[model samples]
Target chain A: MSDNQSSGPLVWLGTVLATCITLYLFQGILWLVVPILLSIILYYVTEPLVYRLTHHGWSRESAAGLVMGGLVLLLLAITAVTLPRFASKVTTWNEQKIISNYVQHGADFVESTLRTVEKYVPFIDEYMMSKARDNANWDEQLAKWAADNSSHTIMGLLHWIPSLLLIPYLTYFILVDGSQFKRFLVRAIPNAYFEKSLLLLHRIDDQVRRYFQGLMALTVIDAACLGIGLKLMGISGAFVLGLVIAVLSWIPYVGSIVGCLLVVLVAATDYASQTWMTYGAVALFLGVRLLDDFVFMPMTIGRSLQIHPVVTVLMIFVGGAVSGISGLLLVMPVLGVMMVLGQILGQLATNDRLTARYQFRKALLRARAQKGLEA
Target chain B: MLFSLGKKKNPRLAQLKGVSLFNDLKLSQLRIVNSLLHERNYLESELIFDQGDEGQALYIVASGKVRTHRDNQPEDKFVEFGPGDFFGELALLEDAPRSTSARAVEDTVLLALFRTEFLALLELHSSIGSMISYALARDLSRKLRKAIVSNENPTNL
Candidate 1:
């Protein structure tokens, strides 16, 4: 809805439609799409430092290589230092048993709430409650499913490892040769639409870059706010939980609910005698959600997307309907990029001189081709 | 520091080095600037840009000719540009509409340095940016002085 994109609601709707369709298509090629998308994020995140080094008289190739090389070394060093400790801690815990315990706690909480309700209205008896509990053996069903799919889950992860490995390699090249590649693409544009096309490219690049950087900054803010709040509330593993919760919240509605439930579950099981802390945790989540609404959301990625709330909510539903969770996760960025593309194409189509020049160029080429061929 | 070294690698480097906006830049610096230019070819009588259109870049004529005229002005009242000459410098600084239209006078090859790219260059390389901005300011100031003198004394232009 910015002035440059005064192309009207149709363009907005088209942007939504294109984004939904693209998200659906992307789901089919997720292995490649996921890595490329991640690489693009990594590229944008590290681009400033690389370009800064280039500005300091270093050749772009060396600058990019040095930046990426240093980053990889740093990451590897961190992993080397932390992974053994993390792995040792994880191995000490019985993950399946822990999950089952949490699930059981959640189910017990629901049953107790129902039992309290039944006490108020005694017509619904213990016989009916037992039948309902038998029907809803969610913990047992989940445990069975996990036990069956353990090897299959490992195989699925193994499938993704190679594609994920492409990130550093792809990011390094994109950092080094991206501008040269852009120039290569620019060469194919005719003289008439040259400026418009180049500007369009710039705008699209800018929109995506802003969206990603904003998201990264937003994540950091969320993690800090939640981590500090939870740590103050005496929540165990507060920072780690906050980090997990923040990353989970990246998936919009589903993520927030799952994240909230996770915190509540951990709270309930960890301190069964102190019920007030669980309520406090829930209140803290609500407080953070409100803060996100009034402040962080506007200050970050939401501003970059620039879509109306109704449309964003609607597309999220449409996205979920079409491609499920991946669609929901990617809706905002896809819609943002699509909106820029739609607006630019709208502007280009409306330009009479540019189109005329394009036609004239085609005519000139045609005449040259036919010069000596005609009988 | 040596222009001849890179110029032999690519002749266009020498041509790019000649533009006063970039003439002071070292050969390696010149290569960075050259990488930013978008080369376009225009046939005779083809409009390069129209009056009132938002200016995004300054164009340097690498070869052939271009002519500029104000809105509704006759073709006779046009300023000509040839090799090493650049136009649309005003666009490089601001997001204002072009005050005049430009068109190719003959088959021409032009190199465009866009505003966004130029601004980034300014932020990135201070010395090179200072040189280009200084040259631009000097040329614009000279034109302003010429205009003032012409208004004060007729036939001075």
Candidate 2:
């Protein structure tokens, strides 16, 4: 008993070390797995469209081909058209607008703030100048850090490029052969738990599908409202602002706030004299958010998801910590899927009280029918 | 109970997969049936049809529960059905009165298609009829198993 007790700590330590090593060794493989998982989810989301076309008497292969072909064409067109336009827009913004305005306003604000501070503490100006010197010299430190980090940085990029390439390829195959993949997955599960596992998987899949579709719908509504509101407010770059808001909305609570801040800042910079316009921009975001909470979210996404705001926020943080922006956007859906899986698994594990009730009702009916025959 | 032997109309209606009769329908037949599906919704406790009502459309529960009952049956004798389960199919296929009255157990959603839809499905894809029949057979077998188990322990209640 003493020996066993003494070995317990050792055993746990060994287990922890083994886990760490295994994770380290398999990190690249895990990176590769992300695109595969992402592609599978994308396939499920897109499959209904293909299925609809096929259902209309089109051949399965033909339907898949047509949809895939159209998607490719659309992507090619967007890349060809949008990429150059976006680049030129960025260039124009940088050359014509960005540097001069930002520097002028920023310099004025800094000078005023420093003057106020120096009025209180005469030595504060010297202290601030030293701080400014430190900031101005930050690039040297960054350069040194970059030199030190070069090997790891290159390695990380090399690691990521293959995973990035895998996404499109994986999505393509998943789109083409998703049914076969499902069959393969189902076959891999043990027979004893096959039915329950399949049911749980299907439930999770359904939840993800509905949540994603609802999110897409909500994104569109958000973009439309934000665009129209901004346009009505006579805000320049309404389309870009709306696009940013729509994309950011995927990040949940923080996303909208960030978009609001950007809009407010832009409004402040654009119409500094017309302060009311800044207030209007803030009001617009707040109003839309209220509408989202009261009507849009409930109508589009349903209250059944019932995720707590705190948990939603925490998940966003955890997701960002784990995988940056993509993780932040996807974490809620991942949590949603996990919640559904937990519910279904719980139901499966529970004693069949409802099924028992069903059985009892069936028996009572059967006995009464037999008695009627005898009479 | 009208069914015509003509080409389909409104392709979008038949394209959805969750309709009760067409849940397992082949892609080829779905295009045919897509023209035949009629979507309908009901409030809580609404009666879809009486047991003796002429059955026209086979009903598929989309988003809510439904209850089916035969006339002269005890109140507790109704069978509860949920999403993906369907009823009134027998009448649609056989051109007869409904075997059971269907009531919305909750705020219910349903997708229905008439005899023409099934006929269109049948004409377009021969495999679907057999697939439905096979599924129904398997479902009946499962029900029979439950019935047998209950019969063995009636006194257990």
Weakest lDDT window of 10 consecutive positions for candidate 2 chain A: A1-10
| Per-residue accuracy of model 1 over A345-364 as CA lDDT, tens digit each | 78887788778878876786
Chain A alone, TM-score per model: 0.84, 0.65
Query: Ten residues in a row with the worst lDDT in model 1 chain B?
Result: B1-10
DockQ of each: 0.40, 0.05
For model 1, the stretches where C-alpha displacement exceeds 4 angstroms are A1-3, A9-13, A55-58, A85-96, A113-134, A146-155, A364-375, B1-8, B145-157
State model 1's lDDT. 0.79
lDDT of 2 by residue, A38-123 (tens): 66655655677876776687765677777767776887798798878865765565446453443333333344445556677776
Runs of candidate 2 exceeding 4 Å displacement: A1-41, A91-169, A322-327, A341-375, B1-131, B134-157
RMSD of 1: 4.3
lDDT per residue, candidate 2, B1-157, as tens digits? 1222234454444435655445687665565454344456565665666665546667777679999877776788778888777776665457566777777888777766556446645544558766766765665566667878777322111
Interface RMSD, in order shown: 4.7, 15.3
CAPRI rating of model 2: incorrect
**Fraction of native Cα contacts kept in each candidate?**
0.45, 0.00
- Candidate 1, residue A69: the lDDT equals 89
